[model samples]
Target chain A: MTEIATRDAYGKKLATLGEIYPEIVVLDADLSGSTKTEFFAKKFPQRFFNMGVAEQDLMGTAAGLAACGKTVFVSTFAIFATGRAWEPFRQSIAYPHLNVKICASHAGLSVGEDGASHQTVEDIAIIRAIPFVKVLVPSDGIETEQMVEFLAKDSGPCYLRLSRAKAPLVHEASYQFQIGRGHILKEGSTVCLFTAGFITSQVLAAALELSNQGVSTTVVNMSSIKPLDSKLVVAMAEKHQYLFSIEEHSIIGGLGSAIAETLVSSYPKKLVRLGINDEFGQSGSYQAVIDHYGLSTRGILESLKKELKL
Target chain B: MKKRSVAELEDLACELRILILKMVHHAQCGHTGGPLSCIDMLTALYFYEMNHDPENPHWENRDRFVLSAGHTAPALYACLIKAGYIPKDEMWGLRKLGSKLQGHPKLNVDWGIEMSTGSLGQGMSISNGMAMAARLDGKSYRVYSLESDGGAQEGMMWEGAMSAGYRHLDNRVALLDYNGIQIDGFVKDIKDVAPLDKKFEAFNWHTLVIDGHDMSAIVAALDEARLVKGKPTAIICKTIMGKGVSIFENKPKYHGVAPTDDEFKIAMQELGDQ
Candidate 1:
């Protein structure tokens, strides 16, 4: 399986897109290299702005550039982009519905070795709460590339969450990407596994293991959290007896909450939400952290068995 | 309309102050002191300095104005009215539900408001982006932002100041309405943003200090700001908390409070409108 960090795909794809879209301008809050926006900065020196280490200034500046008929892409760490500069994001970009893409990298516990201060588990929840903001959490590199291209063409405020750790590719090269659409990676019956972000790889592996245990499982990659693919979720809820949501974020306001919100309104189902149980991340290797947080394949499989009473 | 003379501008300022007061009084909520202190600068910008057309608010080449101190939306609404962006009748709808005129200036580009900026310290950075875009697009339209002394206390404001300076966004002009007062108390008492001009100068901005209410001085400073090259300009306007109403002038108590009926009557009389 081809492995690549979502941030790498974001930076590379953004650089490629810059050649075609003259209006595409990039800004970073002094995390160009880390967030992978350095690729665009190096390629389009004139168009890229390093707004120092100020996230608020970065957001405000991006909104300003967007107002001037430029599609601005501002990059920073997820914690700072969505947490430290939330007000500017809410007021300047989201309120006016500016064409500013907040492509934040290093989201969730996968930002290992940096600890809780760096990991942003509530980004999706907080950003989704803001009006006129379309939240996208691409599961892998290929999806991140597709999301970057989609956002480049589309106008309005977007919060694209990218990951620091590399994940196995889950899509084909010719896979078509759509905004607010979820894809069922694997077909099954009895139970459905809803997942987003880099953790989808683990969830897919868990589903394969469950299949071997005579429990046919469906694997759905719910990348688009906001303007959620409710149609698909409702359909899955009806077809499957048991449901589960897994993510590398807090259980409160990430994939689990989004799915719960969707299911409770239309098709209420008892879902086993798999994620950090409202706890801050600790410094460790990506795999170590995932294992410790019970987000690994074995952990997910055990949780599924328990939830399904198997 | 031709540019008004200094005396005419002062009279216009008084009329704008009356409109702002009446709007706030009607709503029974708003930042009173800052708006009155900043009205003269706003009057000069709307009436003479800015290259904007009320009939064509989205004119591509027109100069952009951002009210960073958005609590003073009454002042901006009055200016928008005077500039024919909105009808005078709508002034009464300030801060009302479903009204175009929000408590903070929301981005109603059709009505000529470039950005929404009730949250302090963020507008200057937006101005920088606008200026950078102007440079990128090769357009000569200038970007102006009006911020308060209290707003300067925010770290983002300095970040914006640094970026504007680094980029040498000469087309961007920021006016710091140093009314020396904030919501809690005097700005000096709360957080001293004194020696404000030196701070801007240190940030590599072309700094200028002037009397905010002096129409000719405000107009001249704006003109001088345009001629400045290789750096953004910050015009520090020394102003009383409330300029027109003698009772409210230099009073921190009137910072965000609307005048009572009796005070409104007295304010209108003092402003020579009632």
Candidate 2:
């Protein structure tokens, strides 16, 4: 329990938030333990509901709770939570801006052994395109905790993207994480690496490797992908001569595209983007898939080196 | 919590219908049939039954209304404007690009619209969540949702129904516009959702069968729904498609058809001095 998966962090934050707000309700699609909402379920059984394995109904039910002024967080894996239930989330939640937080686990390559089908590389893009949804991808365990608490009282609907794998705590316990603000992890001049979710550390590792090879990189833990932390991103891009964005998503509409959009509005730099090259992944081991798809930390370093002519 | 007089409620319903027609006609698109079927129920809730504030749509204690039969958005939109939840001018912009009035009910376009409902069966489950939430919070507000009988075939609607009943959300009220016709043909032929009352009963819901277009019957059924306890209530209001308009009434072809100018004119004349 000490070094918990980010999924369990969701339950802890939700239970804490629920104690404060009577209207807070938690829903799970039979993944209460997996998504860590089981904690809330046990503590506040009346306030928690298990909508079985039906993701679509689960989403609709959360929207219903939101309709009555209850701040509801629905738990499920990222792929089924967003993909299977996208329409209800579209009409009942996002379109209406219902105050339901879709707290999903097993996001990105962190889902590991479940393979590409369960890994949600496109969850951000799918929800970000929605009209009124706020997309939050936390960098690490502490940040994930902070985000769940923040979204609890937030005015509109939000999607809390989480990781299946355990990540080292990035921010200090007292460190505050703002929903739309980007956190500056490390600062340098030659290159700026913008990334989100679990990939924050992956890109950071790549940047560090590049640093040892005589390149100074500015790494931004871009947690709020929808808002893009435009001011910091633009400023970082302006200072760095080159920009590289990486994520555990499709290169087309993921964090990289969002960074490109922000940087385009201000500073224009020679940019390199990396992720799934617009293709669905296959079933494979977690480490094997990361290695095969060239998404591991070493992969990122190698790709950046090749792109920068290292 | 006092009820409005029959005459006032009837007048509100007519006014709402006229407003919906005018907006749909001006916007050059809107679903006309289900709105006609739902006006009475919407009027009963907004003007009489539900506890709500027009000024603050998101007021926590306000009674929630979800139009599960989302194509009937014009009816809900018209009632919201007429009741002062939003400005009346907003209706004219219905279905227009950049307008708050969307082709289907959506929240991003407008504040008063509760949830975006276009796909048929999603709303009832949402209402279940709302009602269940109210119960959990020990709140006085109730949730009301109306789904089309055509929408009844969807697996999720029944899922929500069974769950709402299982949870005993007695404060939740669901109305069905049992007008029979779907897009391709009658529900009996396309997909029979008959035995709906028994289905709900088996789901542990207190059920009521009423004439959908009858003001007295609709209002009385809602009152009875309020008194029921230990289980949710669903009123199966039998109605005719395009109610009150002779030209298109009960016609399946008019399900998604935007009436032509000629059809609109005849329909307007048939509605008679609204």
Among these predicted structures, which one has the highest lDDT?
A: 1
| Per-residue lDDT of candidate 1, residues B105-127 (tens digit) | 88888887899889999999999
| Each model's DockQ score | 0.89, 0.71
Q: What is the interface RMSD of each candidate, in Å?
A: 0.6, 1.4
The 10 consecutive residues of candidate 2 chain A with the worst lDDT sum are A1-10
lDDT by residue (A90-181, candidate 2, tens digit) is 87787677788899998887777776778887888888889878888887888888888788768788888888777666666888988678
Q: Model 1: how far is A161 from its true place, Å? A: 0.7
Clashing pairs in 2: A64-B126, A91-B116, A95-B108, A96-B107
Give a tens-digit lDDT track for model 1, residues A1-310.
9999999999999999999999999999888989998989899999999988888999999999999899999999999999999999999999988999999999987789988899888888899999979999998888899999999999999999999999999988887778889999999999999998898899999999999999999999889888799999999999998988998888998888999998899988898888989888899998898899889998898899988788
True contacts kept of each: 0.85, 0.90
Q: Which one wins on DockQ?
A: 1
Instruction: Report every candidate's CA lDDT.
Output: 0.91, 0.82
Query: TM-score, chain A, per candidate?
Result: 0.98, 0.95
lDDT of 2 by residue, B1-274 (tens): 3478768898888777777777777877667777877788888888888887777777777888888898988888888887777787787788888987788877632356777788999988988887887777778888889888889999889888888888888989999999998888899998899899999999999999998878888889888988998999999999888777787789887777677888878877877753
